[model samples]
Target chain A: MSVQSKPRVRVPATAAKGELIEIKTLISHEMESGQRKDSAGKAIPRKIINKFTAAFDGKVVFEADWQPAISVNPYQSFFYKAQKSGAFTFKWKDDDGSEYTAESKLTVT
Target chain B: MPNWFGIRTATATRRQALTAGAAGALAVLLPRMVLADEAAVADALKKLYGGKAMAEGRIKLDVPPIAENGLVVPIGVEVESPMTEADYVKAVHVFADGNPLPGVVSYRFTPDCGKAAAATRMRLAQTQNVVCVAEMSNGTLFTAKSNVKVTIGGCGG
Candidate 1:
C-alpha cells in the first residue's frame, strides 16, 4: 500500500466485571471508492479495507464488512462486556489481502 | 382454457398471484434514471430478506439531518436486544439510497459484545436516505430509515 496506514485502538486499562465498555478504533487509510476519475478522466480502481474484527481472547466479539462507501480513515466503535481480563485483538483486512492488527489489554475487576 | 363457474376463474387467481410476487421484485429490479442507483439499495434489501417480512422497529439510526460536507458523514446503529446467548443481534446492514452503490457497511455481533451498537463514518454522494436492518438471532428482521441532506458531493470526481 502506498499509504502508511496504522490502526489505533482505545480501551480502558481497567473495568468492573460485567461492565459494558465502549471500544473505539480508527485507521488511516486512503480509501479509493473507484467512483472517482483521475485528471485524465480514467476511472480509479477500488482500494479499501474490506473487513474488520474485534476478538477477545481469540474469540471474535464483533466483526464488520466494509464497502467502498466507507470514509477515508474510517472510525468504528462498539460495545464489549468486560467479563475477564484478556487481550483484545483488532484486525483490519484490506483489498490487497494485507491485514493490520492491534492489541489492547483489559483488566477486569 | 376451461370456463370456470366460480366468481373468479383460475386464470384470474393465477394472474393475481403472479402479479403480487412480481411487485416486490419489480420494485428492486426496476432502475430509475440510472442503473443501480437507488434500485441497488432495494435489491440489497430484498436479497437479505428473501421475501420475508421485515418489522419496522427495534432499530435506532443516528445520522445527521444535514451534512455540511458529504465526504464524511457519521452513522450509528443500535438494535434493541438482550444480548444474551439465547437472543442477540446477529447482523446489521446499512445502505445509502443516493450513492453509486447501495452498500455502506454490515456488522456481525455476538453475545459477548454485551450491547448491539456500532458507529462508523461514511461518504455520501448526495442527500439521501440511510437504511438499516438488524437480524435477530431468532431469525426476525427489524428495520429503520433516516434521511440526510448533503451540501457537497463525496464520491464525485
Candidate 2:
C-alpha cells in the first residue's frame, strides 16, 4: 500500500550565475519510528523517510541518510550554487520502499 | 574593599579550600555530566570513520546556548569547502552525546551543493554537546561542537 505524502521544495526563481542560493525542503510524513505502541498496544512498524536526495541538471547536489530520530514533517535547508538554468529534483525514500519526489527550476542570469 | 583571597582564608579550612578548588577545576575540565549513553557517541564515531584523526575546525555548529524546550532544538551546521568537483565535502554526521541514540543524522553532498551547510530541528534529551563531523572528498574529517542547555519549564524552582 502506498502512503500519501507531499514533498515541498523551495528554490530561488532566479539567481546570478555562480551565486550561492539557499534551498529549503519539507515533507509531510508521519515518520513513525516503530518504537511506540498504538492505542491497542500494538507495535507500529517503523516507517520513516530514511533517505533524501537532490539533484540539479542530473547531477546530485545534496543527500541525507536519515534515522528514526528525525522529527515528523522533516524539514531541511541547504545551499547550492547556481551554475546554470536547470531543474532541481528532490527525492525522499521511506523505510517501506516508498519514494516521494518534488522538483523546482532555477534560472541563472 | 577587603581582598577576596583574604576573606576565603579566614573561614575555610585547608581541606575545605582544596576541595573547593578541585570542584572548580573539575567543573571547568568536565563540562558535560556523565550520561548512560556517553559511549554511544564514541561508538558511532568509530563506526563511521575508524582510527581517522578528525581536525577541530572548518565546521561551524550552531545550537542555542539554552533551549526552552528539549523537544525541539534548532541546529545548523556549515562546513568550509570549495564545493568543487576536485575538492568538496562528502558527508556530514551529527550526534548528540546525551540522547538515548547519540547518532542524530548524516548528510551527503556533492560538488553541486555549492556550500556544505544544513539546518534542521532535533530533539535533545538534556543539556549536552551537539557534534558535527564533515568528511571531505579527500578523506579528511573536520569537526565542531556546541553545547545546549535545556530547562524543564512550567515548574518554579
Candidate 3:
C-alpha cells in the first residue's frame, strides 16, 4: 500500500542537441495483486501500480501502463534525445488510487 | 476357450460405439480449441491498437526471440519521432498476448524528450506474441508485434 519513486535519476550532464541518451527509473512498491491468498486462505486484495509517466520540462517524455502481473518494485529504462537541459519528473499511480512522484535534473549541452 | 465368438462380438460392438462418439465430438469441438489462442491474441491487439484507429508502423519492439528466463525478460521499445514542440511521440503501449495480463507497459513522451525509447525487464508466462503500440503527436496510433518462443516457462507451467 506504500508508493514511492527514486529520489534521483542519472542522465548524461551534457549531450549533442539531438543525441539520444539512456534514462533509467525505479519505483518502490509492493505491487500486490489482490488475487493471491494469504496464510488464512483469504484472497489478498489486489494492490498494483497501474500507470507511470515521465515528463521533461512540462513535456511528456514517457508513460507506462502497469498491470497486477508486473512484479514488485518496478524498474524501467528508456532513451530520449536531449534537446534542452531541465528537470524530468516521474509519476506513478496505483490501483488503490494513490499517486507517487519523483524528479531529476537533466543537463543538455 | 469355448465362448470365443461371444467375447469377440461384444468387444467389437463396444469399440465401434466409442469410435463413433469420439469422432462426432471431435468434429464439433476441434476448431474451437485450435482457434481460441489466435482469437484471444487478436482481441487484445485490437484493444491496444484500435484506440486511435490510424496505425502507422512507428513502433519498434526489441526482445530476444527465445528468452531463457520467464521471471525476467528484457524488452525495449522505440518510436520514430523528432520529439519537438510541433510534433512528438505521445505514448507507447506494450502487450504480451499470452501473458496472463497481455498489457504490460505504457509510456508517454513529450517534446523536450529529444529522443523516444524505453527499456525494461518484464515477466513472460510462456511462449507468446509481444506487441507494441505508439501514439503520435497528432493523436495517431501505430503498432508492431512479434511472437517469442520462451524456452523456460515463467508462469509455474
What is the total number of backbone clashes in candidate 3?
17
Q: What are the clashing pairs of model 2? A: none
Using DockQ as the yardstick, the better of models 1 and 2 is 1
Cα lDDT tens digits for candidate 1, A3-90:
8889999999999999999999999999998877788978889999999999999999999999998999999999999999999999
RMSD of each: 15.1, 9.7, 7.8
Best model per TM-score: 1
**A49-92 per-residue lDDT for model 2 (tens digits):** 98888888887878888766577788889998888899998999
Decide which is better by lDDT, 1 or 3: 1
lDDT of 1 by residue, B19-59 (tens): 99899776774453242456788789888888678899999
Q: Which pairs of residues collide in candidate 1?
A: none
| lDDT for each residue of candidate 3 in B26-69, tens digit (9 for 90 to 100) | 68854432211446656765775543465657777898899888
lDDT of 3 by residue, A1-109 (tens): 3545443456666777778788777777776755456678676777877887878887766777776556667777777777778888777787868778887787777
Model 1 alpha-carbon miss at residue B43, Å: 0.9
**DockQ for the candidate 1 complex?**
0.65
Summed backbone clashes in each candidate are 0, 0, 17
Better of 2 and 3 by TM-score: 2
Worst 10 residues of 1 chain B by lDDT: B29-38
Per-model interface RMSD values are 0.6, 5.0, 2.6
Instruction: List ranges where model 3 is wrong by over 4 Å.
Output: A1-8, A16-18, A38-42, B1-38, B44-57, B85-87, B138-140
**Cand. 3 Cα-lDDT:** 0.72
Q: Please give the C-alpha DockQ score of model 3.
A: 0.42
